[model samples]
Target: MKTIRSRSDRWFDAVNNVLIAAVGLICLLPFLHVLAKSLSNQASVMGNKITFYPIGMHVEAFRFVFAHTRFFEALQVTLLVTVIGTVLSLTITILAAYPLSKPEFKGRKPILLLYVFSMLFYGGIIPGYILMKALGLLDTIWAMIVPLLVVPFNLFVCKTFFEGIPESIEESAKIDGATNFRILWSIVLPLSLPVIATLGIFYAVGYWNNYFHPLIYISSVDLKPLQLFLYETIANTEELLQEQPDSVRLSMAPEGFRAATVISSIVPILLVYPFLQRYFVTGMTLGSVKG
Candidate 1:
């Protein structure tokens, strides 16, 4: 059987499509403008002639940024933190969530309540810094990695997904003489790829874009991440321009340099999304369905 739409339904569909397209354009246009500025010649960029398209296009800004040694150092630091932090966070989240998902686990409610409570409250920046200092983590990469290993939200999502898995599979594995670790490693995790990828990207993005923790705990220039480096670059562009040779300054505008750095910093993370896009929606949907 086929159902026909009324005139009002057609009107509503048209309006919804228009609104969604408008919102998409709003998010996309600003990025296009930045990309234009990065590629536009210094004269066009300074004169505000660039918009969604480049005017008198050139790649000098990218060239200048690529030649910067400090940028590479900061990139190295951010990469290290993002990779290590994501792996450790996913490992801890899975470990903690697995036990909590099982009803037979003792004291599960109280432990879960503690996690939720901590999520809703914080000890403030001063105490966090003091704790990092006391632990000898200040000025080290561990300061960034250790403090954020377990996000309550991710833990809950993993727990919900684990609970959705059929108990029959685990029981079958046990019948084959498999231990708990073997069941999780060989049976459960293999079936939980969607949720794992989802949480993996979440942890990766948080660590990559994290700025406040590094600002508080890291005092050494060598340990600064890409976001902090970009901040300092934008904040001190005038001083940087003065330091550069006259010929170099003439070839690149301050705004162009900033735009180039912004694009460069984000492109790597953006590249990661497409590969995981297939699993993202499925993971979030299935993970939330049970709870």
Candidate 2:
């Protein structure tokens, strides 16, 4: 037999469910409206004709966007940045974080204080630009890859997590005749998967969405990352349309095509997100729990 709730309890539960659904709709409606607008006729959109649903359907915005040569070139650059940047950042961050995680290692305290100090400040853009220029990294992909070799937040989290791990494991490995480098490589790396995966996703997303770096450092049109290309595509649509009178000008930029580009850029990350999502909570919690 089912037990009935009191009138007040039922009312509260009903209100709570309503609130949850309302919040979900608030989040969901915008994406749907964007999708609808992407498919809607330009005339309908320009006059503010559509509301929660599109007034009329159209698909030309995507066609127009894909027809350009620059989109593909920018896409290739973005892929390179996301893949290579993620790997390089992971390598540097993990290598730096691992040593800092261990306290018994000599000079770890000073090195950590140095990392903490770095988090607070940076040489302004002019000096940074001069250094990069002196190094001949300007307009080169290396400018994007080399500048962000260390991440302070990742280092701290990793350090805290490593501190939580007992020193006895390394001691055991050493007692078994394993060298310092060997124990770190063979045991610590394997045990550190959760944090590594977590940081990998974080760095990957940062690289994928990075635009300012491309704007400041890269001079060649070919070197523009996907976000920069997408920004230019959205921001300069009118000028582009002006240059080619007969070519189509998408009024709403076909919410579909814009959404499609966004979705595409994110899909790679999404594919990897599930695997790491499990580790994310645990990895992130390590710092909080240890502290």
Clashing residue pairs found in predicted model 2:
38-255, 39-58
How does residue 130 of candidate 2 score in lDDT? 94
Tens-digit lDDT track of model 2 for 32-92 = 6665666677787667666667666776665566675277788789889878988988888
Candidate 1 C-alpha RMSD relative to the actual structure:
1.7
Model 2 Cα displacement at 251 (Å)?
9.1
Model 2 score (lDDT): 0.74
Collision count for each candidate, in order: 0, 2
The RMSD of every model to the true structure, in order and in angstroms, is 1.7, 3.9
How would you encode candidate 1's per-residue C-alpha lDDT over 13-61 as one tens digit per residue?
A: 9999999999999999999999999999988998998889998878988
In Å, residue 150's CA in model 2 sits off its true spot by 1.2
Best by lDDT: 1
The list of candidate 1 runs beyond 4 A from truth reads 1-4
